[model samples]
Target: MTEPTRVLIVGGGYVGMYAALRLQRELRRHEARITLVDADSYMTYQPFLPEAAAGNVEPRHVVVSLRRVLDRCRILNGWVVGVDPVARTVDLRPHGGPGRVLEYDILILAPGSVSRTLPIPGLAECGIGFKNLEEAIHLRNHVLGQLDLADSTTDDATRARALTFVFVGAGFAGVEALAELEDMAHDACAYYPTIEPGQMRWILVEATDRILPEVGPEMGRWTLEQLRGRGVDVRIRTRLLSAVGGRVVLDDGTEYDTDTLVWTAGVRPHPLVRATGLPLDAAGRLKATAELTVEGARDVFTAGDCAAVPDLTRPGETCAPNAQNAVRQARTLADNVVATLRGGELRPYRHAYAGSVAGLGLHQGVAQIYGHKLHGMPAWFMHRTYHLSRVPTLNKKVRILIDWTLALLFRREIVSLGQLSDPRKEFERAARADREGRAEEPVLR
Candidate 1:
């Protein structure tokens, strides 16, 4: 080998970031040249997103900067438009420049997943997802803004519409998000003298018979009961027929005039997986073996939610597509990548299914860990403890801890900064007025 091996990684999420971090830590500087390309420069710690939305933690602390952590590896903020294993090149369209074919001696494809959406009426325009940091922050603002809208409105219909919140999917994402945000909004009602907590309607619709299926049926039932007690209408075995113009129609013939509809149904593997021309399983994910190497190509590796990695612990089943599995898979994939480069034996990735834990509002939660069940404040503490240790970087962990500490001493801020999304709108209006000779001061606030 006259030249260093060019290792190109596509994605900036769990797998890509972890693999690059591990490779740079384990491999010699000259042995491999690592380049990671992703649309974003940071990796979001998704598990903390629910708390961020609920105002339990600051939104900025939920993401880790790739450049700051992976200092040894080269970072390119771009998109992997296409991948070709036979040609050993990836077609990349960088954020600020022209497209180019990048040659690589080895490839690590882990672009992660996107929200798996269904074709429903008005969904495209009305539904919002709880997938990324931006969505979490926006949802927080939107929810609080709804309260503000309802409080200031004299019209009964408009107030009712503003207070109705609908969430589809009862999985971890949907359940946790609803629980936390509902808790926050409940506390926020104290500030609005005109609004009562009961006036805010919270609804959860699931296509299946249970919520949090990962924790088994018994725990799922417990979670359902807990949510119902809190006035969250959990509609199990129900489907969202349509959300056209914010008129949510359920399969059970129930209807709601909600202004907020959160769609957290599920996710599909990144589309980049199909463009690779590599072998994929029935679910359209890259086919990977127990060793985290893509099948039929020894030089290619894959993991995370985008790869169909065989679960060695359970025969005939693949690893669950969740952050719990993705984070662990990344470690093994990183080790295997180093082994491949060093001509060493690659270890297989295997782990028994540990039970799951979920938070419900502030001091409430449910957990089934290693066959032990816990609920209420204990479960909530466990939820925070587990995630705090897992969230990337000490800086983020510390910042999150401080946020929680401050919450103990003070009430959570419910003020909506909706204008943050369009800070220039007021400025633009003012500039136009000045140009028109109105001679009026612009409202920059």
Candidate 2:
């Protein structure tokens, strides 16, 4: 009676979720028992973040529950603190519990990346991120909340600060977020009697001269011109020096007071990957071969933003850290894993560059696909269609389609649910008031 192999996966992102799905379908019951661990139980489709933040798609639709989809595999909702590959054990701390050690026969390392933020002053205190569903929902609420505040405020300075939205990056995350938000804010102006679209200040400070560099420089320039045409202050070759106390200081000797500061600079490998004590490349990514096996550690496989897997198409380079590659890498990594378990030959992972697509608000986008350039509605349609197809699961696809259909039938949702973040505030205040009222009452003799 031989025991089944235990396979442990370390993330729930694109690579983690897709790899687990493929593995469960391909591997037999007696061959392997798979377990996946992640800080979040649901996988966020990051490509739709801008739309989610803009109210085009509901936040819940952008995320897929790991447990529901991967029913064949065991799912643990927690973080992987560290890994001991030599001993085939991992330090995992489940949510609301102390922690425990999990042993495994094979490890699939796909912890993914964290937002790469700089040591800019006051960024930690004030800046909001756009990496997950929570942040996306919060950004949507906060952006609409600002409109509410600005409309009600009597003072000019307060209204100005509330209306001034500054984003400190021109990458895909920053650009898409800013564009979609600006569009939402513009439409929301109809509801706010005192607030006008022209009064709202939207600024994008990019450290580089070009925006959307992945889509090529010409398209980047076109996107830049389009943004500028829409009254968005797109600053090129600029960097954020400080943002202390809602006062943003640019490196080019310019400063402004703003209540909204969004940081979408970039992302680095997850810190836990380093804690694994495995071999890493100069970029801090785990070094993996073309077969997606971690170099010098055959039992350990790696992919997504955490692993620097060789790019067979480029010969000397590695696969780019994007959804196009991440999704593909997961399938290849899973097939190779099954092959290794069954004593079959492993196949190398290879993918050609597929260009990029970015939506700039509604009915506007830029796309570069296999040497073809598209802009305006055509590109926007492609962006939506491509992501809709790749967003995972028929359930989510239908939900998103329905949302789009509803959007076409009616006006976009502009209401802010900012209170959702602090739902207990009212309860706590009422409880305190009740206690204080009782304290003030006179006691009977």
Candidate 3:
């Protein structure tokens, strides 16, 4: 009997999950066994994360259960520490333990990128990233909590710090997050008589000359204009020199004290790619051909932000790290994998960007689809139409539509559950009381 083709997929992200789903559908039964291992059990719909942060969307809705999605494939929740291409074995550290190895006949590396952080002073301790669901929830709570703090505080310095929001990087993530949260905060101020929208400072700092480089320069300028009109301080060609002592110092000699500093500068490919000893591009992305196969690795394939897929559509450019490329590459990569197994010809991936869409909170947005530029309600409609079509399952799509519909009739809930992050705080206090031999008693301060 011929040995079964064991396909090992690292990461259950956009590329891995979609590719595996397509493979399970396309491949014949008993021919190949798929094993998908990811650090997390659920796949996060990253596009909705800004809405999640702004409390416009539920945090749970943004993450699709991987076990439910990849029912046929073996799912292992573990961190992939290293890969041995020569031995066809993957090293995995299951949650919080020592490493173990799993052998495979074929390897599909879709280990997604992490938050690209800089060595700015105090950033490791003070800064928060907008990558995961936890961060989104924390951000929402943090923002709302700041309003509470500002409302209670009589000190002008404290109130100013609480209201000051600084976002580094004016890409899709940063811009959307800033815009959405600003809208949420502005709306929240209506409930607080002491809090004023004019007191809130929303600052965006971009290192590049233009924001939203994925969108055309014209759209980028328009976005800047919209943000400026909303009273957002847009700083271009500026670098965050230091965030030390919660004091944001720009390279241009401007300094400001802020309680919240959001870092969405960008993302780099997963560092695990380097351990494979595979050839990498200048940016350290796994060097992959237009067909999504890793160079010189016959049984290995890679795609998404982690892989430097050659862009056949653009003569000399590698595919940009965006959801558009990731999802499209997954489809092509799946086809390629199926072709490799079933003795069919593989096709090269070549697709021009469809265009870009961005929401400036609620009914305000900007979009450029198929060469047609749209702004205001048209852009907002396109933004909803495009993302609504792409947000995975029908159930989720309907739920999101319902949420939007309800939002039109009802007001957005700005309440924060800050205790979610510290549920054990009360328990810790009780434990401390027990240790001190002080029975739980109500004391009037």
Q: List clashing residue pairs in candidate 1.
A: none
Q: Of the candidates shown, which would achieve the greatest lDDT relative to the real structure?
A: 2
Question: What TM-score would candidate 3 get against the native?
Answer: 0.97
Q: 1-445, model 3: which lDDT tens digit per residue?
A: 7776999999888999999999988887688999999989989889889888887787787788888977789999888889999999999999886788999988999998989999999788789989889998998999998999899889999899989999999999999999999999999999999988988999999999998876688988998999999899999999999888899999999999998999999999998998999989999999998889999997899999999998887788999888888999999999998888888888999998899998888788888888888878888788878888998888788888888888888899988788888887777777888999988754211
For residue 147, model 2's alpha carbon misses the true position, in angstroms, by 0.6
TM-score of each: 0.96, 0.97, 0.97
lDDT of 2 by residue, 145-216 (tens): 999989987999989999999998899999999999999999999999998899999999999888999899
Colliding residue pairs in candidate 2:
none
State candidate 1's TM-score: 0.96
lDDT of 1 by residue, 1-445 (tens): 5688899889989989988888898899889999999999999999889999999899899999999999988898878888989999999898876898899988988999999999999899999999999999999999999998888889999999999999999999999999999999999999999999998899999998889987788888989998899899999889999888999999999999988999999999999899888999999999999999999999999998899998998899999988888878888988988888889999888988887889888988899999998888999999999989988889998999999999999998988998876778887887888799887664523
Please report, in order, the local distance difference test score of every candidate based on alpha carbons. 0.91, 0.92, 0.89
TM-score-superior candidate, 1 or 2 = 2
Best by TM-score: 2
Pick the winner on lDDT between candidates 2 and 3.
Answer: 2
**What does the lDDT come to for candidate 1?**
0.91
Q: lDDT (0-100) at residue 292 of candidate 2?
A: 96
